[model samples]
Structures are given as structure tokens and as C-alpha cells.
Target chain A: MILSEREEEWMTAYQNGDEDALERIYTLLKQPIYSFIFRCTRDEQLSIDIVQDTFVKLQRYKHHYNPKHGKLKSYLFQTAYRLMITKLNRRKKWRSLLPFLAPLQQSEELPHSDRMTIREAVARLPDIQRAVVLLFYYHDMPQEEIAQILGIPIGTVKSRLHAAIKKLKKELEGGYNESGSL
Target chain B: MSQDPFKQDRHLRTKLDEYHVDVPDFPMKPSRWIRFINLLASPAKDPLDPLISTPSGLILLKIAPIIGTAVVTLIQILMFL
Candidate 1:
């Protein structure tokens, strides 16, 4: 079941020590939270670890959450983003030596031909544009919400979205006639 | 011999949107009491933690003011005596 508005309320209550609310919110948003983290990290073990740690951090510092700031999901995403940055930094040393952290055709499921091409095209964009694309299309976020999440201007979101779409179209279409399916 | 690249591809967007993969979960099952005890026993490593250091450093931080007050009070009492 989708996370209901009541469930979001209950999550805050759970953070405030309502035990029953804890179980309810866990069942409600756990999968989506896991999926979001997984997409961010692109590592299953790390994503699960981060999700668990995010909830732990949430519970441990419930007082730090300012209701005036935004919705519970927004707070959660911000927290996860911070944690993901930390994880990436920590993994940097190891990643440099390995040089294989990002590889072609490495997505968990061997993506179909079209999907693989799209992921490759996405991987080529600059980091900010890549993040904008992921947050916009992957998360199904609105332009204003994407701005809030990325701390970029709404105009920037529009421009990046436009540029990204154009770039992706160029790359994808370059492969279209070759694939003989489009 | 070429398609209009500026023409937006709604199908591509929809296909990308539908891209879903099974992500494995790394679930943590630490009990609350154990987690709490671990929290209390281990010095917090978070940058914001007040006691993010050796026990002596934390003790020195917490009791320094009280110790200063006590020492001054003791000196005053001794002088009066």
C-alpha cells in the first residue's frame, strides 16, 4: 500500500515515541525508502545499510527535525542525500584504486538494450544535470520540488531538464536506426 | 535520413520511468535496548556529538564549570574558617 497522509503523520508521532506508529510507518515507506536509497547508491548492500542507518539517525535525533521545514519525506530524502555523500567520500580511496566502480552494463539487472543505452547516456551528463534528471524523472518530482531538493533555482531546473532531455534525445536517436526497432 | 532531435520523446521518458530493478535490502535488526546501550557506551563519532571524544575529554567538558565553582566555594569557606 502507498504511504497515506496519516502514515506520514504517524511516522512523526513514532519519532516522538509512539511505538505503534513505528511499526506502521516501517511497513508503509520502507520499500520506497529502500528503492530511493538503492537508486542513489547503486549498491544494494550499501543502500540497505544507508536506509537502516537513516531510520536509526531519524529515531536518534527526532528533536532535530523542524516541522516548519518540510514534509517527512523531504526530510528523509535530505538526510539520505547527506548520508550518501558521506558514504561516497569514504569510498573514494578504495574506488580510485579499483577504477571499476562504474562500468558499462553493470546495472544490477542486465538492462535491456534500450535501457542500457539510456543509462550510458545518463552517465555521461555532468553531475548536477545527472542529479536533476534522476530527481525529476526517477522520483517523479515537480520542478519546484526538484529545486527545493537540489537547492537550485526553479529556472535552473527548467533549463537543466530541457538540456538533459535534448542531450538524451540526441544520444538515443543516434542509436535508433541502428537498433532497427525505433 | 534523420529524425528531429528537438522533438521530445514521450515514449523514451515513459520507458525510463518504468525502469525498475529488484534492489537487495541490507536490513538492520538491532534491538532498541542494545542500540541505546551501544549509544551510551560508545563515544558518539558524529561531528555534532558533544561527547565525541575520549571519556576524559567529555568529563572535563561537563564538570569543568561545576569544579571551578566548587573550588572557589571551598577556598571561600576555608578563608572564613
Candidate 2:
């Protein structure tokens, strides 16, 4: 799709070191960006913090951005994922120390809700699987694109996606069996 | 292996898309501390900052590596002697 003139202008001005332009782009993209990060981390607060840190990184490394390689949206998502991984790693360290920090509260379980159940099940997945699942289902990205974005091999993406799907299948079936209808 | 995993389970794909998560907009202002930092580390945009652009300055920049190596070697040699 053709970018609106405003988006193009924002990108042009942003590339030229305009802080206002950066803020404008951040306002425009932050929801979808937060959605992408929230799907990965599943912690609303942590995702917000990571999204903020991602934009700061974008501002600091603004000079390194190349408009030719890809769309600004893709670059923003990639940077956010990298920052999210760093934050998750730090959280892992803190978990080792405290050991009693409550697990992130999960989404409310709904009655006979296949999708919500699957989504909740996916959230309970290990980090890499959760990332792969969300990037696949939520972003609607193909396996190859996901591999490129996450810097993993296509084979790894395929395997993780396969495993994730299997896990979701099990969760859906179990939920369905209890409810006696899908 | 199947063309559509969703085909086997029927409602799977459609249902997968249903669980909408609320993605709140992150509130952030480039705070004063951040502004001060950006100002401090901000690159000299002046196309003519000598430390960055001039030939003599460039040579000094290049010489920095050689000088660093020589100093390290001298210190090591003096320690041995």
C-alpha cells in the first residue's frame, strides 16, 4: 500500500534528525508496536516499558537507520523485539534473586472461548515459542519472514511454529472436552 | 505438512485471531535527563568540526591507534627491563 503523504513526510523529516517527526511517527505506530511486544511478553507493564525503551533506542541510533532496506514499521518492530529480549533476560536474572516474584497475572479465562483459551495457552508458552507464535499468527508473517526478523534459521522457525501449533491444539482440545462443545 | 492446519480443526484459524489483547500506548516524554544525555552524546552536526572532518585531525585520529600500541609496548618493555 502506498504510504500516506504524512507518513512519507514524517519519515523524511525523521531521517533528517527532526525530534518532532520522531514523536509523530512514534504516536502513529505505538499501538501496533505495543500489540506486537505485548503479545510476546504478555506483561502489560513490561511491554510498555520495552516499547518506550525501543523508541529511545530508535532516537539514539537514528543515524544508523537506512530507509532503503525496509519499511520503517518493520525496523521499529525488529528494534522493539531486540529491546524486549534484553529486558526479558534482565527479568530472568531478577527472578533468580527474588524467586518469589509472582508470575505475571494471565488473561481472564472465558467460557467455551477457543481463541481466548488458545491465546492464553500461547502466553503460558516458553519465551521463544511465544515469540514465534505471536509473530506468526498475530503479525501474519510467513515463516521465512519471521526467521529473518528474529535472526533465526528458517528451520528453527518452522520447528518452533510446529511445536507451538501442537501445543495450542492440545490446549484447545482440552478446553473443548471440558466444555463439551467448541 | 497440510496446506492448512486450520482445515483439520475448522475454527482454529478464525478463533486464533479472536483473543484481542489491549495494547496501551506507552507514555514517554524524552525527559530532561534524556534530553541532556542526547545533547551530550549528540553528534556534532556542524559539517566542519575539526576533530571529525579535517585532514590533520583525521591523521591525528589515525595516529591514535599507532601511538596507543607504541605506548603499550614501551610500558611492557620497561617492566621487563
Candidate 3:
């Protein structure tokens, strides 16, 4: 996750109070961070919020960023992932306390989503496993970098990816498509 | 569809590709800007907010008028003396 030269320059410029450099970094990093978060959370608003917070955090902690520490994009992904997990955890706690909110939360689903689609199957994965799958298959991230982002050991990341893939294989055995039934 | 793990991975990725997510562009300043505006648009604080905003402060506020009247009457009695 070492920074490329261009990212290093951006970080240096950002640390020098260059607002436009921060914007440039955001322009480069936003899509990847947003994609990872949206695919992980499956909530557009939540993803946007996390992406926005990630940039804000980057700006707030600009002085702490060193190219020697990691890649800029990985740092962004880690921030978004942690923010998402925290918010989602808080939400689950609230939902448990107020079960009436379950219906409201479920209202995000489509009305016609009866048959299990591939996306649904992925969504049904546990949060930990879903993160692994999305990071690996969707984002094409390697195990070591994912380990860095998830703050887990490389072995743990592999096991999670294996567990996720096994669960996905089981859920998607029937070859579900976006159109519902094959 | 395929028994090979690599092929299965590829197949899974392709299936996931079907779940297209489009990330929209948003300006960086709007969040901070909205927050500043919200702060500005919030209700004005009472001049005595510091005096009455807490329990002790509220008690002090409630007793101030009686204390002022007592002090004024005491000053009048002293003037008579």
C-alpha cells in the first residue's frame, strides 16, 4: 500500500494548506471509496455520507498522512470501512431496542423482491463476510491490503474470504441473476 | 456453473458486476457549508442563557427578583435612618 509518486505529491501539497490539492485527491479517491462503501453497505445515502466523512477525515488528519504509512486510497478505504461498521452497529442496536423500526428499515427493499437474486444473496451475507467478498471479488484487493483495511490478520482475511466464498457458493448455487429466477 | 475455484471466482465477479452501483459527484464544501448555515439559522440564545440554562442557574434566576426587591427596601430603610 505504499504511495505512488503522484499521491505523495498530493499529500505533500495537502499538508501545505493547499485546498485544491485536497480536492484533487478527493476527485481521484472518491469513486473507489464510494464504490467500496456502496457495495459493502448497499445504501446510497450511507455510502455518500461515509465517502464524505472519509474526505473530511483526510483533511482533518492531513498532517498525520505519510506516504511511508500506506497508500492514500487504502487509507480512505479503511476510514470509510470503519465509519460504516460503526454506524451500522449503532443502527442494529437501535433496531433491536425499537422493533417497530424494522419495517421502516425493510422498506428500503424493492416491493417485488421475492426471489433471491445474486445481489440479495450477497446482501444476506454476514457483515464480516460481505466485507471480505466485496473487497476481494468486487474491489479486486489483495489479501494483505484487505487485512490492513479490516485491521485483521492476513490469515483472518483469508479465512473470511474463504468463508464468504463458501457461503456465496452455497447461496448462489442455483445461478441467480439480477432478473430474479434464472 | 464452473467447478474450478478461479472460474467460480470469475463467475461470481461477473454476477456481482450485474449489481451496478453508480456513485454521484458531490461538492466537498456543501457539508461544511450546510453545517455553518444550520449553526447560523439556529435559534438565538437568550442573553441570560448562562444564568438560567442550568439547575443552579435557574434557582439563582428565580430568586434574583425577590433579592433585588429586598435589597431596594433595605436601602430605603437605611435612607430613613
Candidate 4:
């Protein structure tokens, strides 16, 4: 994912404390970030919150963005990914401590549409694999960038994508049975 | 033998395109920003709140006398002087 020169300029300006540059960056990246999060969590509100938090984190940790390290988009995605994992872990712990208060978990019903099947299969993926798949396919990021965003080796990213796609194929083709085998 | 799943990548991409999850308009509501700022401005929780909230806090409370003895002796000597 080579960023355009204009995008890099905006990022640099934002890093230099240009609020307008920050706003532009937000406008450009918001939808894709939100969509990535929405697909992963399947929760609209939580996705929105995470998007906002990602930017706020960018603002708060402005110095952390170094072009020498990576592109701003990759940095933002990395921040959001970490935040999403933290939120999911916290939710899991809360659910375990207070089962009654946990949100109703989605049932493993056979999806009616191919799109729905894809969505369900994605939501069911282990967190790391799902992140890899979303960044790779939907975001059109190269495996190297995904590795940078995930802080994993490109080989690990490749393997995760392979495993995730394999699982999705199984789910979509086999359909759900009473036993809930994928 | 199972088919190569990568062959289905195109299909998955198409399905992903068809999947419509509405993205809300950005530069989120000002009220939300206000709330976020207020949260930032709000006083931080007491540092010892976590320690005191748990059994360790109770243990600290029990040992307060033993911990305070040195300070108490210093105060007594200062007062006598």
C-alpha cells in the first residue's frame, strides 16, 4: 500500500500540528477504518467508537508516527487493531464474570446470502487471522504492509490469511449443521 | 483432495463488496467530542484505589500501625524538642 505523495504531505502536516490536515486525514481514512472494524466486530456502535478512539490516539501520540517507521495509514490501523483486541479481551473477561450481562452471542445459523455467509465466516475467525484477511483482501494491503501493521512476520501474515480463507471456504460451502461443525 | 482456497479469493472479494455495513458520517457529532474531552479532563481515579479496593488494601490497612510507628516516633521527638 504505497501512500500517495499528497497523503504523505497531509500526514506530515498533521504531525506538525495542523488540525486541518488531521481533519483531512480523518475524512480520507474514516470509512475504510470503520468498515474494517465493522466487519471484524459486527457491531456498528463499537466500530464507530473504535474509529474515533483511533484518531484520538493518533492525536495524543502524534510523535509516535514516524515516516521512517511506516505509513500513517498503517500506523492508524495498527493502533485500531490493538485497541480492538483490548476491547474484545475486556468484553470477554466481563462476559465471563457476569454472564447475564453479556450481549447475546450470535447463533451459528446458515446464512441466506453469499454475502452474509462471508460476513459470518469472517466474524468467526480468530482475531489475528481475521485482521489479516480484512487488511489483505478488503483493504487491498500487501502482505508486507499487513505484517508491519500486525507487527508479525510476512510469513505469519501469509499463513494466517491462508488459514482464514480455508475456514471461510469451509463455512460457506458446508453450511452449518446442528453439531456446529465448520 | 481439497481445492485451493486462494481460488475463492475473487469470490470472497465480491462477497465483501456486496456486504454493506453502513459507515456513519465522520467528524462525529460535536456532543460526542465534548463528552470525550470531558472524560479526558475528569480527575483521575486514586492511585491506590485498585490496591485498596482489593484484599491487599485491607492488608495495608491492618499494617498501618506498624508502618506508622517510625513517623510517629519522629513526630514525638520533634514535639519534645
Candidate 5:
């Protein structure tokens, strides 16, 4: 299991209404959840908000987690993902109302770079593909579990991963040699 | 430089690893419910705050006049009593 035994115990205790256990679990998993949201959203304050929301969500949905089905880490990531997606969708609607603001938003979103770095390439990927790449490569999530977290089929996961990898390769080819990318 | 896609994949992983994120310190961070309540009472933090720009906010804005009238009516009733 990606989660250690002690962490799992904390999760169990937390579910049982042990408030003290929450600090331990939050200390352990906060970084992972925050980074995952940050990579996906590229928004600092929004990432922070989503991470806190994920914890609050854990308190609300504690009884809903099943150890047999998945680890607590995955559960937190799934909650964070849903929360981020919901906020992103809401932001999208607002952005749509003022289409002219897109360019201004983009300019502020990324700093000027002489070349496209791997980070920029990853950030430039479509939301769905970027998510698959981050979850698979960064988090080391298996396709099946990723499918569960993302609420997509295994086949879709595979295809999205394939597409994301291909796009990453093309974008990073300057640094990538024939042997492999570095 | 013989072709090994797995090697390329690993390289890509290595490149991806370059993007490191720094996690902010975990204090006893307050729950999001508290944040939302604060946001509603306070000025908008982010200009593009999702709460202020959503249908929920729009509904509230639409009914502000009604709420204001109801509050005034309730205050008048209390004063009369």
C-alpha cells in the first residue's frame, strides 16, 4: 500500500472520530494533495483552497472510504480532483462571460520563457491529458486506480496516458534524444 | 542510441521530476466552510473568485432587494412591539 501502516491507523482513528488523528493524517498527506492540485491548476491560492477543502471533505466523507477498495491517499486525491474540477468548471463559466479576458489571464498565468521547458509543456497540455500525466508519472498511480480516481474507464485512461506521453515527447524533443528523453 | 521506448519513458519521467513543488507549512489550517463564510462577509480575495462569479452569487444578488425589504420589515415589527 502507498500509505504506511501507521498512516492507515491514523485514517482509521480519524474515521472513528478521533480529532487528534486528523492532524497526523493532514501532516502526512497535505504536501501530496497540494502539489497534485497545484500541478493541475497552476494556481497557488486555488491549490491551497482545494487542499483545505479536500481535508474538510475527508471529515465529511470519512465513513464513505473503504480500505479494501483503495488507499486513503487515493481517496484524498480523488476528492481533491473533484473539488478542483468543480471550481475550474465554475471559473470557466465566469471566464466565458468575459471572453476578452482570456488573453489577459494567459499573460498573467505563465512567465516569459525563451524555450518551452518540460514544466511548461506539461502545463500546456489539455486538462484531461495533463491530469493523466500528473497522476500516472508523478504520483505513480496504476491505470486501474487512476481510472477509479478520475472516474474514467481503464481504456480511456490508457488512451489518455498514451496521448499525453506522445504530446510530452513532441514538446520536449529538443532535450530528448533518439535514445530517450532526459 | 538504440531505440528503447522504456528508456525514453524513464527519461521523460526524469524530466517530469524536474518540476518540484514546495508545500506550505501545515498549521491548524481552518476548514473551507470557514473560508467560504469569511469570503461571503468580506471583500472578494481573488477578482475571479468562483463564489462571487457563480450562479449561487447571482441568485443572491437577484434577491438582495427582497432580503433588504424583509429585514427592514422585521426591524419595524420589532420596534413596534
Candidate 6:
């Protein structure tokens, strides 16, 4: 993610205790972060909560944002990604303990027009693969930046993307032959 | 199988364009700043907490032994005088 010079300035000002700069940074980033989390989690409330948590984390760790290290956008995404994974893991553990607490039916809330085969196939992917695909395709992030955000090798990002695309194609084409490959 | 994956990527991108997820309005929460200020203002329960909490304390910790050695040498020189 190539941040504009103005965005970088805002990040610098934010670290200098400029509240307005912080707000501008928040406004600039909230939607992209919200959309990414929403697409990944499929839960509106959880997405909003995670977005709030992401900004709170940004405020707490404002000094950590340095353009020299990486883009501020990637930093924000990394924080949200870690929080989302933790939340999902906790939810999974709870679901295992209480079998009767059914998972939220997110599909039923969507309108018919939004229900595309590709979206469904993407949702069916494992968490890491889904993140790789979304960051690569939806966010227009390069493989190298994706690797930096996810803390994986560039080669692993490429393979995960290829594997995810193959899985999506197979699922969308109705030939989902499970060969025990994740 | 004949379809190129790049073509599929274009198709997926088009499909993604058609769907719009509404972003909810969230007010900026400044509670984190308040918590940080509280941490600074509050008294430290552990003796090491203050040293670890602030940058100046960390610098003092690093130079304390050198300062102690210099003071001891100065006292010895004064005793010889």
C-alpha cells in the first residue's frame, strides 16, 4: 500500500500529539479496514468492534508507525488482522465447548443480488488463504507487502494465493473434490 | 480448465465491484489516551515499574553504575588530599 505524502504527514503529526491529524488518519483508514474485516468475518458487529479496536491500538502504539519501516496502512491492517485471528480463535474455542450455540447465519442477512458464487467460494477458504486472497485481489496489495503484513515469506504468499485461486475455481465450478489439501 | 487464471481474476474483480459493503459510522474513542495518562500519573506499586515506565528512568538506570564509580573515585582523591 503506497501511502500518499499527505497521509505520511498526517501519521507524523499524529505521533506529535495532533488530535486532528489522528482523526484524519482514522477517517482515511476506517472504511478500508472495516470493509476488509467485514468481508473476512461476515459479522457486522464484530467488524465494527474490531475496527474500533484497531484505531484504539493505533492510538496506543502511535510511536510505532514509521513510514521508513512500512506503510501506515499495512501497519493498521496487521494490527486488525492479528486481532481478528485472535477473536476468531476464541470464538472457535467457545463453539467447541458449547455445541448448542449455533454460529451466526450471515448468509441469510445478505440480499439476493449480493450472493455471488465467487463470494461464497472465497468465504469457504481457510482463514489464512482467505486473508491472502483478499489482500492480494481486493486490496490490490502486492505479494511482497502481503508477506510483510502477514509475516510470511514472499514464496509462501505466492503459493497460498495460487492454492486459494485453485480452490475457489474448483468450488465455483462445482467440482470440489476434497483431496485432503488445505 | 482451458480458462486462464488471470481471466478468472478479472472476473472475480468484476464480481467484487458489484458488491458494496456499508461501513458503519464509528466515533473516535480517546479512552486509550486517558489510560496512558493515568498510567503516568499513578504511583508505581513496584520499585522497578517507574524505571521501566519512562525513558528518563531507563537512561538513569544505564548510567547509574558509572556515576557511582566516578563518585567513589572522587571521594578517594579527596581523602588523599
Best by lDDT: 5
- Give each candidate's fraction of reference contacts reproduced: 0.12, 0.22, 0.20, 0.24, 0.29, 0.24
Better of 1 and 5 by DockQ: 5
Query: Where is model 3 chain A poorest over a 10-residue stretch in terms of lDDT?
Result: A99-108
Candidate 3 differs from the real structure by a C-alpha RMSD in angstroms, to one decimal, of 11.5
Residue A169 C-alpha lDDT in model 4: 68
Can you tell me which runs of candidate 1 are displaced by over 4 Å? Answer: A1-4, A94-116, A179-182, B1-8, B25-81
What is the TM-score of each candidate's chain B when compared with the real chain B? 0.32, 0.40, 0.43, 0.29, 0.33, 0.40
What would the TM-scores of all predictions be?
0.63, 0.66, 0.69, 0.69, 0.71, 0.68
Q: Candidate 1 residues B6-80, lDDT tens each?
A: 236765665466557585543445355754554355322244245646787788777988999999999999999
Residue-by-residue lDDT tens digits, candidate 2, A61-174: 877767666667777778888888887677568556654442333442324554347656766677788788787777766676677678899889888877878878777776
For residue B81, model 1's alpha carbon misses the true position, in angstroms, by 80
**What residue pairs are clashing in model 3?**
none
What i-RMS does every model get? 11.8, 14.8, 10.7, 9.5, 7.0, 13.6
lDDT of 6 by residue, B4-34 (tens): 3446465455655655689977676635665
Tens digits of lDDT, candidate 4, A33-145: 99888888876666778898898888888877788777777888998888898987886896677654545434333345533366677777887898888897778787888
Q: For each candidate, how many residue pairs have backbone atoms clashing (under 3 Å)?
A: 0, 0, 0, 0, 0, 0
Please tell me which model should have the higher lDDT, number 1 or number 4.
4
**Local accuracy of candidate 5 as per-residue lDDT tens digits, B1-81:** 113233557767778878999887645466667666644553223543554689988787768889999999999999999
Instruction: Show where candidate 4 strays beyond 4 Å.
Output: A1-3, A105-116, A174-182, B1-10, B26-81
User: Of the candidates shown, which would achieve the greatest TM-score relative to the real structure?
Assistant: 5
Error of 6 at A36 (Å): 0.8
Question: Which residue pairs does candidate 5 place in steric collision?
Answer: none
Give the least accurate 10-residue stretch of model 5 chain A, judged by summed lDDT.
A99-108
**Model 5 complex DockQ against the native:** 0.14
Q: What TM value does model 4 have? A: 0.69
TM-score of 5: 0.71
- CAPRI quality of model 1: incorrect
Docking class of 3: incorrect
Ranking by TM-score: 5, 3, 4, 6, 2, 1
